[model samples]
Target: MPKVSSVIVPYAVYLRVYEPLAAFPEPERTHWARYARRPDLPSYQDELRRSLAGLLPTPPVAAPVQESGDAFVTEVDGVLCVCPWRTRLRGWLALAELDEELPRPVLEAALPEVVRLQAAQDHERWLESNPDARPWIRMAVWQVPLHWFVLVSDEERAYEKGTGEVAPVLRYRTPMVQARRRVARSLRTLKDSMDEGPLVEGLLDVGRWLEEFHPRSLVELDYGGLVHVLPAGDLEDDHSARDVAEGIEALRTGDGAAAGEAYARLVERWRSVRDRRSAN
Candidate 1:
């Protein structure tokens, strides 16, 4: 049995693309190359700790003044792959999404109206100048999005039953081409079986996001810190991608019972993790 610890970590999952160093233009490619060779590069956990610390100020620093210089770097077959920490832009996007979803009073309590407005205007201006920009990372709170599971498989899943300050981790990494192919096939199957709904829309959005990256880039699905909130059994039994694949196949085969069963298992498993948010 995997030993569960009381380590505290953020309850967020991230989908990130690590593009090859060659995919970048000169100066950036040069910069990342040097950064990757540095001996003191921050680990993923270290970066998360620093980011959380930044939110401890009086009003809370929602975003930084400039883009982050750090990146999550990995080596693939001797080639350097860098996923830049575009925290500033990601912050703006997060705020915008929150603003749309939350009530005014609730949103303002965390982010003052003035601060929120300023960030919105800044993002608008920034968008006008850099229309081609796309985020290197996307995050979800509480539970991983079902669409994300489409890009990975059970065999690719990696688990680390972390000890001490380290929390348990679950993630998957697949080449961009495979990820895109899976998304496309899944989208077609879902659309053909059902009407236009959230699943179809979500898959379309994911497909579009994947299209913005390099053909040879690597896609990752990190459970982030949510693993800490789940029970040991849940973590051990998690084969979300496999379940998702089963559901899709069942749908294609017109097997309603099997499809419903797979969908229920996926939803109920994540629902338990999400429901902890309101527990006293």
Candidate 2:
């Protein structure tokens, strides 16, 4: 095998399941995010590195050849990405030299048991800083070449006692919201008869996002959730909501499946928003 020297990576760590922040993109995050944890290319950089440190009576993981605050330039073959309200996230850990697609379940075999053992150390540190009723560490492992993402959330005793939307993570995501609107609009035009391709493509995007997502982000995944489309709901929802209302204006004007589907999507899109608000 060829000797590997260096690579680049990015990563995230989330704590709560379906936490609202899980929906927003990282760059737009509010300034308040910094108080919780350390972030680097493959998140929990120290934990991951300490776990994988090559050899010593008690050695450090291979030092990053170079690193910045969010991305670490190293030779490790793994990466992590941060996800919202703390449920899901993704990051990159570049693996040098060994280039074939990684096998499934390689993480358990590759990372040492001590990494798992060190969990409490960070937990104590996090608790000391914020002292939330509960503290958790969710690690998302991603191996890009293999198309893999695995989640690990080490939650604390206090949180496990609770259930049902305890807290919400505020999100400010422009790109994801734009993509949601685009897809919803295309879906609204399904009856145009001009072509089915665009609408079909929109459905495809919806399916992909739905499948990979947890239930929380799905709530306000859009602009206050889905397109308004007139009498159905508020006008501020977005263009697609207005479009849906217009489409219905041209509908056979009945609550048949097509109308129902459109209306249902409007509701579904806004569900994340509604649910969170209800919880609050």
Candidate 3:
């Protein structure tokens, strides 16, 4: 069997409502400021590097190398980072030294079937197994030449205590909200850049795949790390997979005007949220 490695690369867009922090009394303000100034936040490239570093056999010594397409293949330290770009997000598939490198042809032939087989149960199993982890949010998974990659968000949820009451704590960071905005933006961009081609068809196929899930089921883009770069917005807004499904359909039908309008709405909303953050 091929060696499989599972790693969590931190999402690049960390959306938090920090306005309340400004209202804090003296010492509290000082304490929060310390955290705000921390330098450890991961950039998109940094997240890829970190994920590869953890799964690779040796530490990478050089920057990642881009390939003919949006994919980037690099053999650094002792492992290979097969990073592929999907829409705005980047999927990271780190291959260890010992794992046989599946040829591109083989991967292309096998991945679609593998994705279909796994998609049905992966999220359900993950949630059931990790009871203490954040609740299952949206995720995008993808398969590269040698490995399968996933960009997921299990956002914080209310915890029930022994008294059978849920905690009232508000979850400030909404990864799912940002995820929806990102998908919307990606679909619009994809529609704008391509005509009726394989790429466009592939994305439409993904949209159909999402439609296969139950209404309440969480949908994943399944493009490995490539989905991570999609635009994220304020956590207060609610977004669902259906929104993405509609966007895909619009794009497929050459409804560029409608797609553009949706993208404009997302951009305007997120911009307002950012402006508020700046004001705070």
Candidate 4:
């Protein structure tokens, strides 16, 4: 097995608050219109820099907006930008160089403050008027630098007045979990194919990497904006990690035939799933 070093997993917390333009009073609406303009304008970037200053320990590295309105705009490092639109204030903060153990408390504490600064008064007033709005805050965590696969999890929370806190009320999807299921299924398929090659070796490599993490490690995917566009079924996960480990172990014991068989099983399983889905 290859040595696993201390890897710095890049993580990001995406925060978004949605409110209609009509909900805002006249003066505030005008103010936002100027704030949420095209990124090419020097004034727009400056405004974001000023608003977010000192909000996070690491300042945003200025970069061009990646997309149009309502899209996530960010820099290469820890810097974050709120891509404001007529209806929403959406952005993400990249928490660079996080350890495998994700610090949930630190994230929880900083989120509200960031929202308070970025959303300004709009978030509060929206809640005041809508009162019944479900899950006022939408947050997602992204585990970065995913080369071959990705995993995504969504958490919904409600704000409490007395404590000024956001409590998680629901967590429905975990892409990583689903990926595990697929990997199990793929292993079953590979059982029949039995051809040894680079693909099998690559799967073994992934398994080795996953084995390096602590058992309780939280594996997340960085879906970013694709959460809005991609179908839940289309995303991938880290499910094959264990099986690859098993195959590698067989190879280490000098059982070339056994290693080849393991690879075959994975290949067949994945192919079957793809064919079945395509037929559907």
Candidate 5:
């Protein structure tokens, strides 16, 4: 099958994801090299080629990481690359899913030292390079070879420890949409939320476009609905799963605007709720 690689990183790396993502039209490739590492940038071009061989067999000239990161002056395949800002140290090790032939020790051994090095100091400062010469956001990236450098992050345990939250919103690529919808529908089968049902519906409405929208934000809103406002055992309680087979059907009718509106509404509602809480 496909040989998959993983990058487990600290929550800080997740925060940086949005910054780099905003710069590109499509974030197919990741990372723009910084000046400090310009001479070595060309080497990574091969890594990119190797990484994308299976996924995208036909390759073109190296594309920018996102478009506007503070990573100017880099080398891709020995060609010079320029990033707006320095990279960052973030990310932590977690689970990895890969092909049967993939090496385990290579992946594991790489992350610990990478995380440790990144933890020690902010080696490369990450930024979403803008005209103002200031970053919309900035963080450090922790590099560990053998890991395809998807998420540059730090440790998870320390993050939660400092934040003092039970389950932090994992700053990682997540496929939480259908899973959370299933959970919401299951709860609805028994007893649903009066106010929060709409939020769940909004998420359901997004459909495929949900990926275009940040799943991380959607996950955040859902967590708030379930944990903060929704009742006890609302999500975790055992019950007959609600057959959202009807709503699922509606989503397939080619309603991109409706789907977009629903997703946007959920985000707005979340913002409103979050704002109110902050004010209190």
Candidate 6:
């Protein structure tokens, strides 16, 4: 990979699942177990830098056609867990969406139509061969999606204040079983209490995503570099998961006013955060 800039953080939030080493098959399981003890494990910043570099070639490729060998590693109660960085697959998925959404001229400047078409074809071929493939990580560029909050709770939140060159960090981690249960509950609450709409649909999607992972995996919601732009106070007091939970409970009890207040706070907080994109 090319040398990256000194910038330590990227403005994106990630929802990742780290599966226990035992979840993988033979050789792969041994690979990650040994990989866990390596001194030169890649950092999230390094992963972001590597991805940025991939876009620099002419007719920029959004993702490589080959699968990535890297992963995000973590430990749970002294047990190793790994989240493979499916960069190529994610790139194909993203490129396909961009191609559909952006006008021909605008997209051509960054990614020519032919390149996009080829990536799309490659992705289709991948799906044909590996029908069960699923991404372990989901990212949102500026602000985290509201439904992601349902998988966690305020009690799980962790905040690490930045010092010197280090960037501030905010995240939440929970067991996959817990995340799946909460998503199921949230979806039931929304479906029973309200009309079918985006919120219910989104939670359903999250539920499906969680189902793809090992039941022993861990789910995480990392604020990524967004903490750098937010005020220290905001990072300190943010309880979006709690807010989401309260809103759902309010709906369950038919407290429309309370639910509206909680939902309003969440929208306003994220709106301010999303507005930072324009400021940049």
Number of the top-ranking candidate, with TM-score as the measure: 6
lDDT of 1 by residue, 76-124 (tens): 7888999998888888888879867788898777778777788788889
| TM-score, candidate number 3 | 0.25
Provide the TM-score for each candidate, comma-separated: 0.93, 0.23, 0.25, 0.24, 0.21, 0.94
Question: lDDT of each model, Cα atoms only?
Answer: 0.85, 0.32, 0.34, 0.36, 0.29, 0.86
Q: Which ten residues in a row have the lowest lDDT in candidate 5?
A: 143-152
Name the lDDT of candidate 5: 0.29
Cα RMSD for candidate 1? Answer: 3.9
From the highest TM-score down, the ranking of the candidates is: 6, 1, 3, 4, 2, 5
Candidate 6, residues 48-84: lDDT per residue as tens digits? 7777777798868777857888898998998889999
What lDDT score goes with residue 73 in model 4? 32
How many clashes in each structure? 0, 36, 14, 9, 32, 0
For 1-280, candidate 2 gives per-residue lDDT tens digits of: 1213232122222222222433335663342245224442232333343334442334323223222223221111231223322211111122221134445356334534454234334444544764532212223332011001101101100111112432211112222333345445545545453355534654654435433543333212211111111122333232333435443444434435666666566556555545644554
Of candidates 2 and 1, the better by TM-score: 1
Residue 212, model 1: Cα distance from true site in angstroms: 0.7
Query: What's the residue-level lDDT of 2 in candidate 3?
Result: 16
Decoy 1 TM-score against native: 0.93
Instruction: Write one digit per residue (lDDT tens) for candidate 3, span 1-280.
Output: 1112234343222211112333345774565455444444222344344435532433321113321122222232332222223211122221211125566566444343344234334434544764433211223222111000011222422211212231112122223334344444555666675665654564454444333323323222222232232323222242322233444456767897876765565555545544644554
| Reference-based TM-score, model 6 | 0.94
Error of 1 at 10 (Å): 1.8
